[model samples]
Target: MATATYPPPPPFYRLYKDYNENPKSIPEHPPPIEGTYMCFSGNYTTDDVLPSLEEQGVRQLYPKEPNVDFKKELGSLNRELQLHILELADVLVERPSQYARRVEDISLVFKNLHHLLNSLRPHQARATLIHVLELQTQRRKQAVDDIKSGEKSCRNFSWSLSEP
Candidate 1:
């Protein structure tokens, strides 16, 4: 059977392109906290500057940012994963009739998942794995249902042709 290939999904490609074009900037200062607060001097309108203060406090109190770059790095990795999956989906759609190709695509997905989970901390990895598995299960079930429906329709058509 011939294998087919498709381009990345629209959203995935868009996100990938955006990431490629505009990589996130790691802030030199910490991100700002939302709300007003009081300082020893008096009532201080601490808007965004407090992130540095908060960061200093954290640094002084703790050994380090225990989850260093947790937000930014995970977010970037997630984008990469999304792009990979979208590419895989495109390939699978193109090669629907090729069992070997489908297998290869699925294996690639598992490998990606494995690598992603391994890259995360244990707690975070567990949470991410659960969500990813749920999504995969739902999509796979829908695909299976669609294939079954198509097969049934084909069978019905063949029967009708033989009868007439």
Candidate 2:
């Protein structure tokens, strides 16, 4: 297999086309890392340079965030979506043109539900891995048992033939 270049050049390497083309005129100091507090920008988006973030609304989590019951939350959202859809149906039937807010509510519910499901992806992957391992273990045990049974039958046949 071909070896990949170690510590491949940063994404911004292309920006330094001149230096790459002529290797000797390197700058006096290496370029600062992308997110460093430089030039009065004060590391605008880096977590360390800013106060604690209080981001609002729905956001996904990886490997399942602690203390949140994904199953219950999903159930609640499912119910909420069902309710919104029912409300939308009523509005469509009674006042066909006045369903905008109901549609918006349904859209919001769907977006939240999607975000919640995405947060469950890591959890689902782990669960699937565990189930696959369990099946593999069961198959191994069954194979071992079958081999043992076959060994017993072979020994029984050899003894009977020897006695004859």
The models' CA-based lDDT, in order, is: 0.59, 0.73
Using alpha carbons, what is the TM-score of model 2? 0.58
* lDDT by residue (tens digit), candidate 1, 1-164: 86559755665344445555567732245576556666786766645232332343321211134455545645654665576567667766786565565555445544444443454556676889999999999999999999999999999999999994
- Which one is best on lDDT? 2
lDDT of 1: 0.59
Candidate 2 — which residues are off by over 4 angstroms? 1-66
TM-score of each model, in listed order: 0.26, 0.58
RMSD, one per candidate, in order: 28.9, 13.4
The regions of model 1 sitting more than 4 angstroms off are: 1-59, 62-121
